[model samples]
Target: MQFTSGYGAEPGAWRLPGANLRSYTDMDQFVRYAQAAERGKIQLLFFADTPVLDVDLERQVPHFAIDPLLVMTSIARETERIGLVSTASTTFNEPYSLARQFKALDVISHGRAGWNAVTTSDPAAAANFGRAVPPRAEKYERAHEVLQIVQALWGSWEKDAWVLDVDGKRFADMDRIQPVDLQGRHVASRGPLPIPPSEQGQPVIFQAGGGGYGLELAGRYADGVYANPYTIEDGQAQRQALRDAAERAGRDPDEVKMFAGFMPAIAGSRRAALDRRRFLDESVDLRQRVRYLGAMIGLPLGYRQIDEPLTADQLADAVPSPHDPRSARALEVAREGWTLRDVLAHGVIDYHPVVAGTATDVADHMQQWFEAGACDGFSLAIDGYHDGVDAFVDQVVPLLQERGLFHLDYEGPTLRDHLHAREQYGLDPRVTETAAR
Candidate 1:
C-alpha cells in the first residue's frame, strides 16, 4: 500500500503530557523526519496547510506560519525520492500563479511534487482574503473553475515543445505550445505557462474535501484523494462512491487513488501504545477540546462544562445551517447520543482512524483494510515528529513489507511512479495511464 508521512504539528502534539518532542519550529527535526520516511520508502511527505488562524482555539505553533510550498522545497533538497505534496487553496490563490509554483516545485524535485488542492473553508481565511466567507456552493464553483484553468495551463505545452538547438539557433518549437485561452465565471487564464512539463509531466493532483461536491471534484481530476474514513465499512462505501462518481465524470475510476488518514500510536507493545495514547489525549485543555468540537459542529460550545453530559435537545439545537461536511459529521455523532464527556475522553476531535499497537498488530489491521478493498493506501498522521515517525518507519514498515503489504524499495523517482506501483498488487493498470494523461 502507498504511504504518506503527514508532516505537521497540531494541537497537543508538542505539549503532550510527559512527551519530550521538539517544537514544530525545529527545521532540523523536519529534515530528519523526511529522511526517515524516505528510508522506509514511503511514497510522499504530505504537508497540511491552512490560510489563516482562528483565534477561538489555541495551538503552540501557528498554523500556516511557514508556507507549505517553501517547506516542501526545503524538504526536497534533503530527500531524493519521497514525493513532496504541498497544500494550496483555490479560494484565495490565482490559478496561473499557483500552477506556476507547483510546476517549479515538480522540476526542482525531479518530478516528485504534488499539489493538495483545497478551497479554504475557515471564515478566518475569508477575512484574510479581504472578504466575507462565500456560500458553500460559490466556493465549490470557484474551485471547479480554478482546477480547470490550472490543468489547462499545465497541459498547454507538448512533450517535445522545448528544443535546445544551438547549431540551428532555434530555442523551442513555438507552434507546439498552445494558449490555454480559458474563460470561466470564476477564473480565467490567457496563455501557456512560462515553463514546460517536468520529467513526470505536471505535478500530481491530490484532493481532500468532504460531502458530495468534494467527492465530485476529486473524481473529475484528482490523481489521489485524501480521505477520512473511520472504519473499514466506511472506507469501502466511500471508495465505491468515489469510483461511481469518476465513472459519471467520464473518467477511469482507478485513476483516483483514495487514501484514508490513519494516525497510529505505536510502541514495543500494544499495551504501551495504548498508555501513550491516553497520555497524549489528556494533554489538551478542556476549553480547547470544547472549542474544537464547537468548530466541528459550527456551534458555540465553549460555555458548556466539560464533565457534563450533552442533551439530545442541545445537540439538535446546535446543528449548523448550510450543512457543510464537518458539521454534518458532528450532527451524526450527536444523533448517536455521544455526550460531551464521551467526546472529550474518547478523542473524538481527531476523527481519523487511530490504531495503537505493536508493529505486528498495526500491520494486521492495515492488511485487513487493504484486502477488504477499503482503501488504496493510507496517509500516516503520527502524533510526534521525530519519535512517532521513526517508530513507524523502523518497526511497522518492516512488518508490512514482510507481509507483502508494502513496497520494499523505490521503483521509480516520481510521485506517479510510486502511485502506479500499486498495480502489481491486483489493481487495474489503466488507472495510471489515465492519470498520466
Candidate 2:
C-alpha cells in the first residue's frame, strides 16, 4: 500500500533573525500552512509534542506555541484532505479524556483527526506529574493496559448506537449504546462515551515505541507506528517484525502502517545540497547541539567535559536498557565514542539518510525503500519549514509522480479513508482499571 507524506510541525522552525515571529505564534499562520500543505498534495499534518517545556530552549527563542489539538481544529476548518494528527501523552491523561478529544476532533474535522499516542519519557515530565521520578518500565506497562481500555471505550458506542425514534419518544436506542465500564492497571473510565461513534468509526491510533513490550502493545491496537529508523534496511526489518507480531496477535497484519522519520536535503545540484547540510551544521551552536543530541540518545553530556573514547561498558552502564530489545543502534554509535565535534562534523550521531544527486537520485532512494518494503510510507521532516518542503515538491515530488510512486490526488475525503485503512476494530470495548508498562 502506498502511504501519504506527513509533516511534523514544530513552532521554532523558521528561525531567521528578525523574521516575523507572528507567523509561528498566530493561529492564522497554521491555517495558511495547512492549506499550503494540501496545495502541495501533502497528505497529513502531525504535531509531535511533550508536556514539559525545555527551560533551556526559552533562552534561544520565546516559547509561545498553541495546543496541538486546538491548533489542529483551527487548521481543520481552514483546509481539506490533509490529516491532522496530535501527540497526546498517555502517562498523565486518562483514557476517557483522550478518547473524547480525538473523537470530537474527528467529528469536527469530518473524520480527519489522528492520535499519536505516546508515553512521555522525559524525567521532567514525571516531575510535572508529581512523581519524584517517573516509573520506568512500569509506565510502558501501564500504557499497555491503558491502550486496551481506550480501545474498549471507542468500541463502547457502536456505529448504530443511536436509535433516534422521535415518534415513539425514544431519543436514542439504548440497546446499541454499549457501556465500556473499563478498568486497567493505570486507567479506568466507565462509559457510554458522550459522543456517538466517530465518522471513521475510531480515530487513527498512532504509536511511537521501540522495544519488545512496545511492539506487543502496538500489535494489539495501533493502526500506524512512527519510528525513527536510521536506514531503509532498519525500517524494512522493523516493518516485518511489526507485521509478524500483529498477525500473531490475531490482527490483520497489513492494517498496521509503518512510517519512518526522514529528513532529506535536496537542491538543484548535489554539491548545493551538500553545502546546505554543511551550512546547517556550521550555523547551529555546537554546545547546545551536543546537549540536544545527548538528550536524544539518553546521555547527560552537559554535566561532564571528559574528552575520551566511549566504550560499550560506558554506553551500556548509563542506559537502563539497550535502545530496544532488537537493536542497539544508538548504543552502538555511543560506544564508538562519537563526540560532539565528531557528530557535527560527520552527521554520524543521528545519521540521517540523504538522497542527494538530482531529483532522479532522490526518487531512486525513495523507490528503493518502497520496493524493499521498508515502510508503508514516510513522515517527511524538513530541515527548515516551507523551504525544505518547497524543494521536495519542486524537485523530488514530480519525479515521484512521474515514476508512479506518488498520488496525483487524494483517495478519500477523510484521512482514514485517504490512508486506505480497513476497519480492523468493531465496537468491542476492552475495559481495564489501569495500564501496565
Candidate 1: residue 342 lDDT (0-100):
52
* Per-prediction tally of clashes: 0, 19
- lDDT of candidate 2 at residue 170, scale 0 to 100: 88
Give candidate 1 regions above 4 Å deviation: 1-10, 16-23, 55-59, 286-349, 421-437
Candidate 2, residue 408: CA error in Å? Answer: 1.5
Q: Which stretches of candidate 2 lie over 4 Å from their true place?
A: 1-13, 17-19, 58-65, 132-134, 163-171, 287-347, 355-358, 424-437
Clashing pairs in 1: none
Alpha carbon lDDT of residue 264, candidate 1? Answer: 75
Clashes of 1: 0
Question: For every model shown, what is its TM-score relative to the native structure?
Answer: 0.80, 0.78
Candidate 2 lands at a TM-score of 0.78
| Model 1 error, position 119 (Å) | 1.7
Candidate 1 residue-wise lDDT, 403-426, digit = tens: 888899987988989888222111
